[model samples]
Target: MTLKTCSRADGHVRAFPLARTLPLLGALTLLPLTSQAADQATGEDAAGQTASYETTEQAPRSEYLSDWYNQNVTIIGSKNIRFGPQQVDDIYLEYEFFGRKGPWDLYGYIDLPKFFGTGNGADSGIFDNGSPLFAELEPRLSLNKASDMDLSLGPIKEWYLAVDYIFDWGHNSNNRQSTLYAGIGTDIDTHTPVGLSFNFYKRYQGDNYGAANEDQWDGYRAQAKYFLPLATFGNGAKLDYVGFTNYDFGSDLGDRDASRTNESVVATNVLLYSFTHLRFMAVARYFHNGGQWNDDAELNFGDGPFHVRSTGWGYYLGVGWQF
Candidate 1:
């Protein structure tokens, strides 16, 4: 029998043996498996591997339940950014990774933002020649997956406990700050995908990892994310939207003289268009960083946290490849 093969954009090929025996739907169905296993970069269709394939001969389920999570990575850039409470003019770039290993769901990202200025202040041109870098790591342990048990409670598909850690430095401050988070999260996979989580965080600042903090705080933060799909363009192009928000209610500040509540709200909306593995995204963001930990005394950052406004909005446009 002659084999028929088709190539995906990522240079992965799928072979079909005896095309006459395979219906078009079956053949198309097989396309994604090979395509996903081939690229492994751009995220796969969440529901693509769930269907069963059948013919004169029986076919197995398209996907096998695995002990590991699928690996996905996305890199993005945002330019002409303007955002608030602490109005900032900067260019931002971020690289995010998501994956599962054993019973752990690992996710995190690195960010670098080049600040041009605050746009309206004495320090308006302060960051004209510099950029600050940030990095985060989160590895969550899923009780249901680890124990091979279905721990669904009502509409929740899966529940896990996670620790999130973040570090930031570089913009001329030799000192860095590390924030640690502990939380529980649930995934709701209804018609739309949603994530909900609550976490407690504490931050430490200094040149060393365990250095004493000039300013520290403990707080609880709640976060939510929703995925919305728009229209599908011809030939597999798609428009998608995601809205994410986080609210922090700080309980205490280590600095005895600090009076601000350290409470804050941050929200972002991202609209993205994807063709093959390439994506173009537009982002709008709102920030109200009510908690400022005296930057001048702690990090010697000048006006401390007093320089930033109480609220502001920002925008960005960027292109990226998912791999």
Candidate 2:
């Protein structure tokens, strides 16, 4: 018996202008780091209320970020989207449940995806046509207040240890990769409606796409998220920005002599508007050196030079309802 592997004879490659914009982008990205350093130098504590900023966890009145719905469900749909070389219309739905009990905080969410179509020649099926019924369920546990560990310093208002587990099941299980991760998270005082967090993660991967080389992929990941308010609409309506940046230091694969191995970054900046229980979002996304899934799809199972530029940009608009 033999397997018919798809050849990259028609694969496309695009020029990455990353080198030209990196310097400017680098400066903007350093803002949080610089602020964190300055706060530490001045011994700024998140204890008392400052003139400009307050924290979600330490405020006397308990101000929850976004609306104060402890347990909520969100369903969003995106269409007429441009993602890298593909034009895709997909539907996304998610549910989040959060709670605090004793000394521990638990939060979890389930994400579901349904792909309708793709414009490019890429496969459209959940397994082939570039679209997959990709879905994930992740639960996170935080232990900071429970352990009575004073992990705060300067603008580093609070620090906690977290353990997360992600269960993936979708399509022909092409996206079936579960992950277990442990890491430390920190919160800092970045005035305005913008909040900042920097965290590090050590991840262990599970089998996927009939590949069981999960052991060869234990590595570190650095992640950050920001929340920025843009403007106010009528009544309780407001416009805001929230997104994250991530870099994964994936383990070496195949021969080490390959030109470009693994090292990828994903960043998204979103503009969101809220009106009552409904919200709308428009986001610009950037991907560098491809992410794990792209890497997996581009892997050459046969003999040939594998070339796929993982850098690209995309745009998406979505609407969601909260209950």
Candidate 3:
């Protein structure tokens, strides 16, 4: 049985898994971040720029040996987010960034969950001391840039040493989670309309709700991330479709081995509209055996009832300001 973190008014104890990093509008970080001038790093509208994975125009290797960065802050409202079995509503403040320098490509976001109150017992609001904070960082080293090589062959344009880092600051030390994923990644050129990239990572787990898998080598995650510019308004507003899929497997955390399952997947699709300083996003996400919990698994712990029903759909909506 899973541990219940919150007691319900109906005399049933429930588990309130902190909404781990609601990545609603953060998908823009994948739109290749608008390039800045060599001197001033101010952001501009570079949605259909050469930084796209499906970009047909290839810049010379000598051009990108310097720094280019952009940052933004957004307020997002997300619902039915399954960090664990139970879905949660999260209104969070997120800080997102993307940068490219020399051989490096980086993207990251920090989330302060429940910046607005969700009366659902998990988070009271930002002013509440019990709210959690979460973040994810991805840094990739381009092999082609590092070696000054022409690595493109057929559909593959570039290769990278990719890494993903996640940190969840829960309400207490016992509720925290820190995880690292490291492996190889590649950008694929479809030679069509969309930009695409893929990564395969091995997971290194850290502190996570005092689970049996803590501080150990756990599993693998194969992910595909892609984006497409959809439309542009006469007023300089732009629309885009950007999404990512995470397939996690190869672990002892699931099925007959544990209270959870050995595999899971989360697929998120989004629609984003951007104006000069305004951003709006809509997202639909599907989760199967989320957080490795089996949908049919039900058990009890410490005289309390614990049920695991983790498979379902989740949605997110956000309106924000991009700096």
Best by lDDT: 3
Clashing pairs in 1: 41-323, 82-314, 84-312, 85-309, 85-310, 85-311, 85-312, 262-291, 296-304
Give the per-residue lDDT of model 2 (tens digit) for 169-250.
4334553445566688766676655678666777766643433335444666776766665655334355555666767776
User: Which tens-of-lDDT digit does each residue in 225-301 have in candidate 3?
Assistant: 77677866544566766667778899776533466778887777766666544666666667787677677667665
TM-score of candidate 2 versus the correct structure, residues matched by position:
0.62
Question: Which candidate number maximizes TM-score?
Answer: 3
**Which ten-residue region of model 2 has the weakest summed lDDT?**
1-10
lDDT of each: 0.39, 0.39, 0.57
RMSD of each: 14.1, 11.6, 8.3
Using all chains and alpha carbons, the TM-scores for the candidates as numbered come to 0.61, 0.62, 0.78
Give the alpha carbon lDDT tens digit for every residue of 202-297 in model 1: 333233222233345456666665555565543445665555565766544434344233555656566655554445555555545423322222
* Model 1 alpha-carbon drift over 4 Å, by segment: 1-86, 115-132, 171-175, 189-217, 254-259, 290-307
The C-alpha local distance difference test score for the whole of candidate 3 amounts to: 0.57
TM-score between model 1 and native: 0.61
Residue pairs clashing in model 3 are 254-260, 254-261, 254-262, 255-261
Candidate 2 local Cα displacement, residue 114, angstroms: 2.4
